[model samples]
Target: MPTLLVTASPHRDEALGNRLARQIAARKGGDLLVRDLAAEPLPPLTVDYARALTLRDPLPRSNATLELSERLIEELESTDRLIIATPMHNFGMPAALKLWVDYVLRIHRTFAPTPQGKVGLLAARPTLVIVSSGGFHRAGESKQPNFLTPHLEAVLSTLGIRAPEFVYLEGLVGRRATPEAMIAEAVAVLGDAWY
Candidate 1:
């Protein structure tokens, strides 16, 4: 089964959920692919990119940027298990996540253009999202905790994926907590998932 770990943080070595996913993959005898969006940034959608989209049978132009975008989408379509580890920013996801979404959710690949309505091309799969933030956001508590989780859920659901399992590490600041403690909490919250 294919597994994907999409992360936003610039520092690849510091994500707690990434570390957890690695350990689980090692034990399970599988490969873990971490697509660091920060390292490989997609260009802001341009006229050329739009033109390529309109073509019935498009060919990659000299820029080679469209080729990279297609490769990224292919990887997402193949992955059976997915993990998105992100640090909540401004009560939402970082730009890296948004960029990845822009690439993978392309037409004629991840979705189909239908006369009735938009249809998801992906099969239902399991996804785990681990969110870390300095503040707290409870379902029925905390007036101004964060808006990241809801947005993530909606996007993933639209892609024909199962409801994502969420692990939120809140109050990371001034908690006097160790990284181990935080990871253990995450494991507890998510249980023995695909990791």
Candidate 2:
């Protein structure tokens, strides 16, 4: 499968989420496209880009922002599977990942606005989200609110990605478990899901 791996962690080599995503991609064994958001951060949305989406006319590709948006959408559309590895930043998505989301969630390109509501235009695909956090944030066990998962779910659903699977590596700062142990558990969980 053609896998698109989008990683947003600033930790680089030490990011467990990114490491796990890479391992999953390797196991899937296909053409891998890695978008390291920290290494190459996307620009924040400009007023022109926002206005372009609202226009009834086709978006002008001549605009640099629109061009980048189109390219990001194309990457998402071409992927057979998508893996997003990110660290939860202050109970929500990091700036880089949110920027990527802004670019990909185009008005006429990825979704259509209807009288009832916005409708997704893209096909649903296999998507996995790997989220890391310094504290526990898994439903009932959460010590704090988790805005990241809900936001991502809604955003991906808007782009026609239904029920994307999520894996969490929490309590890294608290050291509830060693990094190796946590990763092994996560890997085992994934293997079980696939097999």
Against the hidden reference, what TM-scores do the models get?
0.84, 0.93
Per-candidate alpha-carbon RMSD to the true structure: 2.7, 1.7
lDDT of 2 by residue, 1-195 (tens): 798999999997579998888888888797999888999989888877887987677565668898899899888888888999999999999999999998999887899889988888888878899999999987677899999999999999989889888888988897888888999878776734332
Model 1 TM-score, 2 decimals: 0.84
Model 2 lDDT at residue 60: 59
TM-score of 2: 0.93
Best by lDDT: 2
